[model samples]
Target: MGIRDFADYLGISDRAISNWEAGGESYRPRAASQSVLDTGLARAPDEARARFADALGVSGPGPSAAAEMSVDSHKFLPVFIGSDRAHRLRTQMTGETPPDWLESCSAIVAHPHAPTCTLHVFACGVVVFHILQPRKPASLTELAVWRYRSYASDLPWARAKIHDLLGEHHPHGPNPEYVLSLYWLTAGPWIGSQYDTAMRLLSTPSVLVDRSAPGGPVPLDGAVEESLLATGFDHPDIVSFGVRGVSTGYAGWSGVSYAALSQERSLTVEELVSCELIVQALWCYTHHIQQRIEEGSDPSTPDRYGWRFLRAANSRLTTARAQETAQHCLMREAIMRTSGLAERLRAAQEALRESMG
Candidate 1:
């Protein structure tokens, strides 16, 4: 029935029915009036019933409607870390225990059924700990255990690689390149892509040198120049190695330089372990930033600990663009799911009306 007909049938004014149909906050029907309309709709003609259902935003049968709902209707998982580990690390670093809240962050990583994305966020927390308190690098080991315990079945190879790396001893020190390769293997495809892209951006010649001087080459700091050289790009022509210019030879050179020169490999085995930990931590940091962006949180917002580790890593790799890309990807998935759900609902409602008729 039309709104006017329904209003007359329910003993209400047409304007009141119009207000209910419009769904304006100021004109919400009382429970009795709403129940009266529901009863009328329940007994109405098929076409009129469908029309009223549409006006009321009732898409289809409740069960079917719920089944077709999108990810937008579900809450995203929160980023979590091990509170006990975080507190222990904090205590080790500061010679005092952390606050209660800081010590009470959920131990999401240890939970066997935690989502993979949540585990990634926990990995980032481990990285943050490594950066903020290098003296307490045990978090990385804990992260490895968490990852293995939580995802061993799905990511068996990654867990195996972690075991091999941690269990085996390297006399010459674990090659930074080798450690990084393992990280890429375990980090999943998207994170590996982000790391490669970030590395390429850092290695760009224009980024390394002064832009204004076409003739005169800018002198880079010794370490910066060394790192660039290690990437196999000649000083002035480094721009030739664009975003997709990653190479194994360059990786080896860079890895060795990072391990030997940057980290100073004295105890070879420990140095290798340290190299793996550092690379994994950096990747985790990148993932953390991406997770924050997807959660609709401000990526740059200051936190309790001021995100010292994230800031330090970003200073070197500049994860802003990569994080933006991740955010866009998440939004696209949500939009696609929403669109799909709407289409499915429309189809289901049409089918329902056809069956009713």
Candidate 2:
């Protein structure tokens, strides 16, 4: 088929089809578009299919379009943990009896900075943790550390903040019931907030003082080197060190990955601890806001209404302080969502005020 005919057949823009035909190193069909292309090839005449497949450099319709096109799924295998193992770990970390519903839960660890690290605790006690990464894959140990830290340290602060803001007898410390309830309500936005925080930190400019380079500290974008400086991160064995914007091959997600020259050193414990605190704080604040929305007591409030089902599963309390907390949460979310440089700066200023007060 001609480009226009193929575009029409695939129900996509002709430009996209043209990009596909041009066979550039970066162009690839979208996942949905790829599926359509595969289906069209499957139904095409054998000769036509062979021509199209040859143009795209694929064996046939059976293989992934990513192979023919310069597409990447950014997919990774999940580290599965049975409910019993998760519960035992939780108990060991927090010294609390895990909720009965934890028996069917599984944890997935992906890229630490990716917003995909989120927990979903079902009413029946089944929890699924989706861990995503921006560039490299995360190990099971890294995932476990994040989980343990969230439960042991982050959860208590979240609970206390909620109780203090709402002026309720909410459970204190890392009680599994309260923790799970809170996660169920706030995990989505909280996870996003954590990712935003990491990105913000990564975006900061910094100098990498490579010992091998006698020329003094070299300047680089902090975002690329932030992952390298992270604890337990193994430096990629490649020798290349430069920045290039690469397509993640996934729609709506694209960024630059830094190729850093490997050094024989790692981030200090204090530096790692500081970075972890920033991440933990973002999650805590978001959780606080989610809790306030739940405790707003007015079903008409949009945030509260949206989370009604989750609220129903947990205790409800309301107060003037809780409303104020909701306002702060809204402000934080707004700051995270801001786009323009000036707008973001203003949002950050306002966030400072919110945090101080």
Candidate 3:
């Protein structure tokens, strides 16, 4: 959209728009004007939004026909710190008790630096940090691009935060990597059969976003669904975990993502977040065991969190309770498979069992 056209679309004067643009990156939009800009972006046509996002040099929302979807981003950073270290760290943290699912397995603490960040210290010698960033993205492609672009900063932030949280208790700490991500899609633009397509693309953003671009990430094409519909798209990492139309989700290696679409009943955000916590914690736990085996060492932990704990965790993850909703089970399994937790759990269980012998 041209300057005057965009100004008129926003129902604002051209000179004001010019001033804002002339101010460029340094220009901070007035606090009150932020809502106005947000409203304008929300009401703008998909085509115009795409153009705007492209001009900003980022992967944009979906194609012209695709509706804008609201997504709140969640980042999971998991690392192993050993059971003894986790116990010592908990004494330094002032946080609430964890939920029922994680109460026995892990200790939940708030990240001191970032309000939106929380740290989960598991008894199994792994810690997962949960960072929440609310976003109104046009498409999963935008999220994929946003995630990678910020990863450089996110990793360093996690490392520093860990050191601060652990204090001088331990001089050595394991490096934490980007374990996974989740998007609680509050409002979806797709309908009926389109849910499958959205879930598929959500699992694999590389399909539309080009992450290897010169400057930063950009969209591969203006239209995603059209191209996907033509040839059909699927990824081994993508796992569908919801019924059609009602509630749909996809879990992939990068993250577990879900959208609540049920009219009769909707799954709570707390429910989804809790599931992600379990998935991420388990992924971290298994990664520690895997790392030990690779280093040619027998995994060892306190008696309570030894081979028996792995067996119990495996059952907790692989088994589905009757009271839980189908969506819950589907999402859990999807995350498990995508993270390769099941395989790792099995291997860990066997290795630890042999150690016991």
Pick by TM-score: which candidate is best?
A: 3
Lowest lDDT 10-residue stretch of candidate 3: 57-66
Candidate 1 Cα misplacement greater than 4 A, ranges: 1-85, 88-124, 127-269, 299-308, 314-357
Span of 10 residues, lowest total lDDT, candidate 2: 243-252
lDDT of 1 by residue, 32-119 (tens): 6645544454345667645644664542222111212111000112222323333443343323224422222221123233232111
Model 3 misplacement above 4 A = 1-67, 96-115, 168-172, 191-195, 212-218, 223-226, 229-231
The residue-by-residue lDDT of candidate 2 on 93-192, one tens digit each, is: 3223245411222333233344544433222212333333332213212322333333444334433432332345633422322221101000111121
Candidates sorted by TM-score, best first: 3, 1, 2
lDDT of each: 0.31, 0.30, 0.68
Count of backbone clashes for each model? 0, 2, 0
After the best TM-score superposition of candidate 1, give how far the Cα of residue 183 lies from its true spot, in angstroms. Answer: 11
Which pairs of residues clash in candidate 2, taking residues 3 or more apart in a chain or in different chains?
111-132, 111-133
Q: Tell how far residue 188 is off in model 3, in angstroms.
A: 4.1
State, as a TM-score between 0 and 1, how close model 1 is to the true structure.
0.22
Scored by Cα lDDT, where does model 1 land? 0.31
Candidate closer to the true structure by TM-score (higher is better), 2 or 3: 3
